[model samples]
Every structure is written in C-alpha cells, then in structure tokens.
Target chain A: MTVSLNDLVFVAMALVIVVAATGVVMLKNIVHSALSLILAFVGVAGIYFQLSAGFIGLVQIMVYAGAISVLIIFAIMLVMDKSVEKTNLFSPNIIRLLAGMGLTFLLFVTLGVSIWFTKFPVVPAEGPVDAVGMLANLFMGDYVIAFETAAILLLVAVIGAIILAKGAEDKQ
Target chain B: MEHLFINIADAFTGWLMNLGLSPWWADLALLVVQWICIVTIVTANITVLIWLERKVSGFFQERLGPNRLGPFGCFQTIADAIKLLTKEDIIPSAADKLVFRTAPIFFIIVSVMLYVVLPMGDGMQIVDLDVGLFFFISVGSLSTICLLMAGWGSNNKWSLIGAMRAVAQMISYEVPLALSLIGVVMIAGSLRLSNIVAAQGNIWFIVLQPIAFITYFIAATAELNRGPFDMPEAEQELTGGAYTEYTGMRWALFFLAEYTNLVAVSALMATVFLGGWQGPWLPSWLWIIVKTYVIMMVFFWLKWTFPRIRMDQLMSFSWKFLIPVSLANIFLTGAGIHFFKWMGW
Candidate 1:
C-alpha cells in the first residue's frame, strides 16, 4: 500500500523505457523507430537520475538522448525509402529468436545474482566546497589521458562524418 | 549532489525545527516551492518572450505589430492563444499523428529544462552540478530530435529538408561551441556556471578570453538558428522550412518556441560569459534581466541587419575558422593557466 518515492520513480522509468524500446523495435517506419529510440534514451536518462548519478544522468540525456539520436535520425533521412518496413527481415529465423531469448535469460540471471549477492553502498555527496575542485582534479590528473582520448575520438568522428556526407553530396 | 539538496532541505527543516516541527514537513514544503518556482519562471518567460518578439519585429519593420487588441499590443498574445485553442487541430492525411502531436510539446519542454541548470546570478541556480556547462550544451542538442519529428511528421519534402538542415547546423556548430567553452572552463578551473561567474568576480572571461568569448557568442547565435544562421527556416530556400505544412496555431507554437529558445540561449550566454548579473548598483536579478534583454535586442538587430548566410558558408565557417581558433584557444588557456600558477600569481 505504501510506495517509496525512489521506488515509484524507478518503476515508472522502467515501464516507460520498456515501452519505448519495444516501440523502437516494432515500428515499421525507420524514422518512427529512430524517434522511439530517442524516447527510450530519455527513459534511460530518467532512470539514471533516479539512481543518483547526477553527472552521468545529464550526460545520458545530452549525449545519447540528444546528440546520437539526432545523428541516427539524420542518417535515416539521407537514405532513400526502400519501404523496408514490410520486408526489413526476410522470414524471422527460429534460431535467431532462440538465441535472442537465451541471451536475455543469461543477462537476467547474471543481473539477479549480482543483485542478490552484492551489498550496494550509497556514496555520500562530497560537500559543495570540495566537489568542484575534486572533479577538476580527477579529470585533469588521473583521467587526463582518457579525456584527451575522448577529444581525439570526437575529432575522428567529425572527419569521418564530413567525408561520408561530402562524398554523398558530390555523388548527387 | 545529495548533500547539496540535503543542505537546502535542512535549512528549511532547521527553520521548522525552530518552530518545533518535524523535518519531513519542511522538506516537503521546500520541494513544492522549488517545483512551483521552476514551472512559473519557465512558463512566464515563454509567454513574455513571444510578445516581445512580435513587438521587436514590428518596430524593426516600421509597423505596429498586433497593436489593435491591447495596450501597445500587449494582449495580442492572449488573443492569439485563444485563436490557437479554438482552432481545429488537423493531422495530415498520411502524417504520423502521435509523433506530430507530441513533438512541439517535447521541444518546448526540453528547451525549458535547459534553463534549470543556467544560473541567473551567483548561487541562484537550480542545480549546481560540476558539469553544468556541458550539461547545458548537451540539453540544447536534444531539440534536434524534436525538429526531426516535426519534419518527418509533416510528410512534406520541404519539412524534411528543413529538419535535416537543422540537424546539420546544430551538430556542426556544437563542436566549436563546446570547444570555445573549454577555454572558459580552463580559465575558470570549473564547469559549474556559478563558479564560472564567481571566477569572473574581478575580471570577466571576456577580458581574458576574448577570442573564446567571440567564438562562443557566434556559436551560440548559430545554435539558436538566429539571423544569418536561420537557414532552417529560410523562407525563400525551403518554403518556411521544416514547419512548411504547419498552419494556424501549430504554426504559432513553433514561432513561440523559437523566440523562447532565443531568450534561453541569450540568458545562458549572459550567465556563462557576460559575468551574469554582476554589475554596479543594480540588483542581481535586474542585472540578469538587463543583460538578457540587451542580448535579445542584439539578436533582433542582427536579424534586421544581415542577410542569411549560405548554408555551405555557415558550415564552412564552423569547420574551417571557428573550430581551429577554438582548438588553439583551449591550448592557450591550458598554457596560460599553467604559466600563471608556476609564476605564483
């Protein structure tokens, strides 16, 4: 009869995420599927907020929910309509379905075991005074290399996308 | 983040405890008040910005805009609201109705959400996450999905081109926008907007990072798709662009959303780089209002002054000029900071 706020947020987020993912999978129109994927990503971001990962939650909403979804939709727009909705897959293979089911079962089992065995600890929020400086130090000191790598990765992506889009324009 | 909320909540609870009440009631009261404040500010801004846009545009063109209805056409927006509410909502014959109906609302809401993290003054922000600047840029990017929805949902080729243009413009400009801010973030040594403002307490970012500031200003203007960068809605090229099929009230929603977003981005720029509400004599909120309106006016001025840039040139400017300069600025900031620290400044 009594529902905790966090529990309610978690359940609602999960339901929305599941519905969105299923919508993404089942939509016949590629564009509609891309839009559904954005909704699903947003749902995941909601769950991230509920899990108390403030930085991760915003990044989820921004990078994946915002940027990548747009990229996917833009890519969908570039391709000519083949009406793949009806013939996207040639006859659903039973083996593929079984493999998918098996993978899902394994994932659930592993997740359940982790949930049962692990004693999760909530990390206390560092006082606001130390927090900003601490984050800056983390990124600048220990994770400097990773940050640099991410910048490089973004550079590579920009180059590749420009090449692809430019080639298409030239062809046209 | 938990402690941050807890402290704010505890301050209220501490007051309640003075009155000999439990902390739970104070926490509940604080939540209700903050949520209400957030909704009020966002809705109020959207409404006022819509009216302001029409008045500004009319003044720029030598005509009184919507002046027949209310004092100085103030309530023109109100009449427009009534018109929209009473109009029959039409779905295109082959349009995806669900997405079409939902897209505008999402666009408005997402744009509104970006303001939550934007600080109007020192310590006057909703959330003070360490990644506030990054968070703001990221949230703004979500509008592209809404654009794509509006485009595809219309089932029109023009709409689709407009949406595609938006996607290209936003993504292309995002690099320089984020990169320019890295210089500010480097100089400030923090990504928190409040911290950035406080860092500029003595000297603003514009003084130390002028190149980055200009780069950021241009990128922000482009990001909002204003004036010369307003290729997505360039009427001549794309026939009203992505919202080509939209008519009546649906058209108005897009118009209102665009102006509101312009205000949001301008307010954000003022906060992050313009020393946000920090000024002589004036109160913080008033300073914010003055700076925001000034930026909005500049937007209107640019809209009237310059012709829209060709799409290729706009994209080329970002990739060729802005991106390279921003990259250099980032390095300069890093070296500058290191040199200052080494010199014991």
Candidate 2:
C-alpha cells in the first residue's frame, strides 16, 4: 500500500502522456498538436525507460520523438496557410460525434478487458538484462527473414518515393 | 590520480550517509552534486573556449583579437555574458509565446543531457547506460525540435528558412554520422562509450577505420553546423536564422548551447576514434580534455579557413558523398572483422 519513488515517477510520466495525448487531439493549432504529439512520444519513451527497455526507449526517442516529429512539423509548415488563425477543425455534426464517441468507448472497453485478462510476467531480480544483445540475436537468428523483409520493404518504399519525386521534376 | 574524482565523490556520499540520510537520498544528493559540477565545468570551459576561438580566428585572419578587457582578453566572454544577462529580454509581439519561451530552455537542456553518456574519464560517466552511444545520439537528435520550435515560434521568414535548412542539414548528416560509427561499434562489439574506449587500449579506431574516421569527421562537422557546412544561421543570408527573433539572454542561451554541442561532439569524436582517455603521462581525465581540445582546434581551424558552402552543396555533400563513404566504411569494417577472425589471429 506504500507509494514508492518508482510509482511516483510512473504516475508523473503517465500524466504527461495522457495530457499530451489530449493536447494532440484537442488543440486547435496544428503545430501545437504536433508538438504535443512529440511530448506524448517522449512520455511513452520514458515509460519504456522505466521498464528498463533502454534500447526500445532510445529507439522510440530517435525514431518517433526525433525524426518523425520533425517530419510532421515540416509537413505542417509546408501546407499550412499563415493567414489561418485555427488550422485544426472539428466537425460539428452530432451524428459523427456520436459515432466517434461510440468507437472510442468500444476501443477502451476492449483494451481494458484485454489488459485485465492478460497475465503479466514478472521480471527476474538477478541483474539488468542484456536487452540489446537479445534483440540483436532475435533479429539476426530467429527473425532474420522478417527483419530482411522489413529492410527490403523500406528500400522499395525509398525507391518508389524517389521515382515519384523524379517524375514530378521531369514534368516541371 | 586516476581515482581522484571517484574518491572525492565517494567521500562526499559517505559524509551525506553519515548525516543520517538514506542510501537513496544520499545517491540523489550525489547525482545533484555531479550535475552542478558538470554545469560549472561546462560554463567555465565554454568561457575559455570562446576566448580561444576569438584569438584563434584573429590569428587566422592576421588581426588582434579582444585584448582590452583582461590579459589577452581572457575575461572577454565573462564581460559579454554579463552584458547579455543585463540586456532586455524581448519577445516578439506576434510570436508563439510558449514555444518561443521554451525553445532556448529546451535547447540548453538537450545539450547538457548529452553529457550524461559521455565517458569523461575511466569509469567517470554519470549513469553509464548500456546503450551510451545511442543515448547520446537520440538525445542529440532532440535538439532539432528545439530549433524547429525556435523557427516556427518566431513567425519570421528568415527564422523559418534557417530552421528548415538546419533540420534538413542535420537530418542528412545524421545518417552518415550514425553509419560511420558503426565501424567503431563493430570493432568494439559494444555501444557503451567506456567499452568502446577500452577496446582502443591497444590501438585507436582512427588507425583501423580510417575511412570511418574521415566520414565521421565530415558528417559530424555538418551535424554540428560548423563552417563550410553551416547552412543554418548563415548570417549574411538568413540574418541569424532561427535566432533572429531572440534577444538578450535568450539569444545567449542559443549561443551557449551551440558551443556546448560543439564541445560534446568534439569530446565524443575523441572518445570514439582518438583513443579516449588513454595516454602515458597524464591522468585519464586530463588526457580526454587534451584530445577534446585538439579536435576542437581542428573545428575552429576549419571554421575560419573555409567559406560557408551553398545549402545545396552541403546537402549533396552529405547525401551523395558522406553517406556512401560511410556505408562503404561499414562494409570494409565488416570484411576486416571477418578477415581477422578467419586468420585466427
């Protein structure tokens, strides 16, 4: 029944995640929303760090908070009109709102039930796990095919993007 | 000499424990003390570095640097710091108030966060995370957001353009930077900064992975936004770029953060390639400082010697040249590792 420092930190990080996520959804300024998304990403990374998944946490920060957030902001800057006071608009239709609320409620219920039913594994107290090494082994040994497939998929996407960009230049 | 700082830290922690503080509270106190020491060292070091940079640049240009304030103008930066602190803090009327206010604060915080993973000496890191190098890189990447925030929040064309250029340049160079380090990581078989340094006990990675060293240097230069690759904040073109809307202590914070990043990257370079903290005559900490300063001198030399490159040229240099070169270095490193293993050496 005693609240420890770890629990306090977890609560703080969870609050950050929830508040930032809310900001992402409710903010009228698209840029502010994007910034909120970054905060939420960082909070999630903090949770990963708290769970001792340092590799995953660092990857989360690097890929999500760092690169992806920048990309999102860049896109926002490219498309946004300077004259607009509020960029992000919500629909006023009651039917759409009702539908959205229903869907969100359903999702929450499903996720809550799954979490309640799931049995979590207890981590051993021996020492810190070599998460990075185990991940490397998983990728290279057991999941090599899946890993290589993801790599090839990324390469193909890059090539397709380049081709699309090059075609637009040719037309210009 | 090697354990001097460690012993002092232990003694301080013991004293706190003797005062009836719990182990956790005592450890937290020690961490706070380390944080204060790092901040003080960074500030003091930056004071000297700024003065040295001015003197070196003046030497390069065959002109006398500031020599009026103190002996050889050694106190010039302190004077400037006071002036900056005393100057009026101006926030643009049209600016995004929250983002503008938080940008420099976040930038400096991100810059200082990089020190956590830096192996200052033998067993001298703060936390010594297993993925130390990755932690440095990921935390370093967060600075791009600070710049973006500065640019977007300023609501100025020049600031926006400069920030865009900076983000593009940083993103492009980051790939090569990470790739170039893979050679060292492959050789060391670990991403921990201390472990990488330990692997270099016999020979420096610079001697082994020459291509990686070269590519890493080039990429790091671009990443740090130094001269020849400083597309962001191209003063003549963008007029201070992301810093255009900032004034007084706010602008000073950005300047301090940039110099802080310069030192951190230089120190990392020393650790990765130049055999960190390894020398005969001096203590490990002193050795790291010497190597970091030597690398920083090269940075200063390059900055003063070369004209700023065109933005297009900078992008192409990183994407077309450095990336390929770094990728080839990774290949070569893998081949060499396998070759060494096959030879049963």
Candidate 3:
C-alpha cells in the first residue's frame, strides 16, 4: 500500500478543521472564537474540495465562513456591553460541563442507533466530477420544488428584515 | 499552437523527470513553481494597478499624476513598497495581537488565491475546476471575514463600526451580485470560465443580457468597496474606517489586497461579460489584459464620478432595485432564449 498526495491533504484538512473547531469553543474572546470558527469553516470547505465537490465547497466558504462569520462578528460587536470587555470570559462550571457531556453522549447514542438501524443509500459509481452540472441538474430538476420553497423562505426573511429595520427607523 | 503554454509546461516537467527526480517530486515542484508565478504576477499587477489608479484619479481631477519616478511614475509603487517595508509595525496596546497580526495576512491570501479559478486564456488556467464561476464568487465572499477581522482586531470603536458596515454592505450586495450572473450562467449553461468564454464566441453576454450586465457592474462595484459605495473607508465620516489603526507594512498588505481584488473583479467582468481573451490578431492572454484594463478604467471612472451614497440608501438600492432587476433579467433571458429557439434561430 502506498500513500498518495490526496490522502495527505485530506488528513491535513481534517486535522485543521478539528483543531480550529476546538479553538472556537475553547477561546476566551468572542472575536477570537469567531475567527477560529472561520478557520474551521475553511477546513470543512477544503474537505469538500478533496471530495471533488467543488460547488459545495465554494458554497460552504461563501455561506458559512464569509456571510455567517461576518454576521456573528457583527452581532457580537453590536450587542456586547462595554463592561464585558474588561471581565475575563466565564469558564463553564462543573455542573455545566457535566450537562454538556450528557448532551454530547445523547447525540452520539442517537447517531449510532440511527446508523445501526438504517441501511445506507446506494451511491452511484459514475466517477467523473461534473459537480456543477450535477448540482445544477439536481437543483433545477428533481429538487425544483425544494429549491423554490427555499427561495420563498429567503424572501420571507428579507421581508421580515425590512420590517424590523423600518420599526427601528420609526423609533428614531 | 493554441496549447503553446501547456506544451512548454509539459516539456519542462518531462525535463525534470530526465534529471532523475521522481514523478511526485517533479509534480510537487511544478505546483510550487506555478503558485510562485501566480503570486509574482499578482504582486506585479498590483503595483501597476496602484500607479494606474493614481494617474487615473489625477486625470479626472485635471492634474498631472505621479510623473517623476521612472517614466510617468511607473516606479512610484515600488518606492512606496520599499518605504512601507522600512516602516515600523505598530500594534495598539488594546489590540488583540493574534487577530491583529493574522487579519491582513488572511486578507492578502484570500486576494491572491482568487487567481486559481481565473482562466488566463484557453488551455491556460492553473486549475480549471468545473465550477470556476462559483469558485470565483465563493472566494470573493470570504474577503468579508478578513475585513471583519481587521475591524474587530483593531479594538477601536470606529473600526468595529466600519467592519459592521462592511459586513452589512458586502452580504447585502452579494445577493444582487449572484443574481446578476444567473442570466449569464443560464444562457451559457456552464459555470466554468473557459466554457463561459467559449459560449460567447458568436455574441458576448453583455450584448445578449444588458440588464444583467448593468446590475453586475453596480453590484460588483459595491462589493469591491470602491468609491460611491465605499462606506467602509469613508475617511471624512469614519476617519479611515476599519483600517484606522493599522500602520506600516501591515497596512500596505491590506492596500495591496484591495487593488488585487479590484483586478480580480475586473478580470471576472471581462471573462463573464466581455468576450474573455477572444480578440483576433493579439494573443489571447494579451486580449484578456486589454479587456480587463478597459473594464478597470470604467471602474475607476465610476469611482471618480459618483459621490458616496448614504449607507441606508446604498443597502436599500441593492435590495430593492438591483436584486429585483437581476431577477427580472433572468426571467427575460429564459423567455428570450425560448423565443429564439422557437423562431429556429
């Protein structure tokens, strides 16, 4: 057996994602945590790239790392009180840590049970990577209804955002 | 003949094999060499772009631009680079050192990595991924996080405000930008840059979809944070905005990233709308350069012509006008394509 460059890259990317994700939760500063979250998001995008899913990888970067991270940072900046800056971030107490451990255990058990109960879907073996075409076909053809529903959901969100902005304007 | 660059590269890699290097080593070397070339080209182009923008701005204001250093101030940027190199990097006492140091590096990396999907000419891309346009756009989206990092890391209230405004502006304009390109993607039926270019052989996408072109240009300008939409760097209002605290070479990297992004966007406009590298007589790469410069000039003109709009007006215009217009353009394109097909043309 021989190791290939692809395997090496996949390992590196996976490690980066895991480490960065850990940093996200462990960091004291919210801003640093958000930045760590961006790194984690980028690593996940890299993993998608390694899977030859270029379109999904790019969308991941755009949505999660780009828009979501920026939104999170903006929200943090806007809502954070000044006094919070001076104080050290509160570490979780033992009871809270135990609670978190319990939740993680529950999630793991749920995932394992589901995996054991359900058979995996058969994935097609057509190996050529026409990711863009395949994704576009899926989106516009078989998943057209789901796609349109997503668009409507976004439209509703936009309208809701506008109303919220207008209400703030009236208050001013 | 069309595969001139590809042939030269194949010959070089083959030579590396003859020199007793393993295939993997040669391939790795080739990859490194290609990345270095790309980075060098981007850096060199940024220098030229900075000088050109200055000259263009000067011309707009009816004055002589930088005409002293090396033939119409061609070397002005190089001199500025050296000056920046010698300057001391100052981190504010209150700044988060980790984020502050990393922000500009991330910004520059994102700026340069945009070159990966760009097709220099036919058979001339570094890596011609199938989703080239999507990759281009998604990479462009990541720059907002860089701005956010820069803004927050500076630890200044004004910087945070600028960063917040930037995030809002970028994310808002992003919708219109993506929507504006849908008509082109629909007509071309491919997301790859080379395929998109090939599809425009008979007629450029700009001619076929003028509405989409207009919307794309406007949204891209906003995305670049150039003048008229430059709330992030509105000096009079925000006092240099998110970059207020950065000094020395660190500051210069951010500036470099800005111009690099400018060039990248202009190149995208050429590839998607104007026929990319598709002119007769001149080599294809040269044609791309000419087209890209032409588009860049228009961007510069827009920068000098329009005054910055109010922040609220900017966001409103993007959401209300540009997004709807782009959506309509897509609808019209689909209908028009069907009509043409029905007419047997």
For the second chain, the TM-scores of the candidates in order are 0.88, 0.99, 0.97
Model 2: per-residue Cα lDDT over A1-172, one tens digit each: 9998879999999999999999988988888888899999999999998888899999999989888646655666666666534776677899998999899999999999999999999876743567778898999999999999999999999989888878645554
Worst 10 residues of 3 chain B by lDDT: B1-10
Clashing pairs in 1: none
lDDT of 1 at B229: 92
Clashing pairs in 2: none
**Per-candidate DockQ vs. reference:** 0.53, 0.76, 0.72
Q: For candidate 2, write residues B178-209 as lDDT tens digits.
A: 99999999999998898999999999999999
Error of 1 at B260 (Å): 2.3
Poorly placed runs, candidate 3 (over 4 Å): A83-93, A109-128, A157-172, B1-4, B22-24
Would you list the rank order by DockQ, best first? 2, 3, 1
Best by DockQ: 2
Q: What are the chain A TM-scores for all the models, listed individually?
A: 0.73, 0.86, 0.77
What interface RMSD does each of the candidate structures achieve? 2.3, 1.2, 1.3
Best by lDDT: 2
For B170-287, candidate 1 gives per-residue lDDT tens digits of 8889889889988888777777888888888898787899998789888987888888799988999899888887777777677767776787788877877789869888667678
> What TM value does model 1 have?
0.85
Expressed as tens digits, the lDDT of each residue in A1-172 for candidate 3 is 8998889999999999999988877776666677778889999999988877777888899888887765566558565876434333544598887888899899989999999999989895654567667777899999999999999999899889978878644554
What's the best-to-worst order under lDDT? 2, 3, 1
lDDT of each: 0.78, 0.90, 0.87
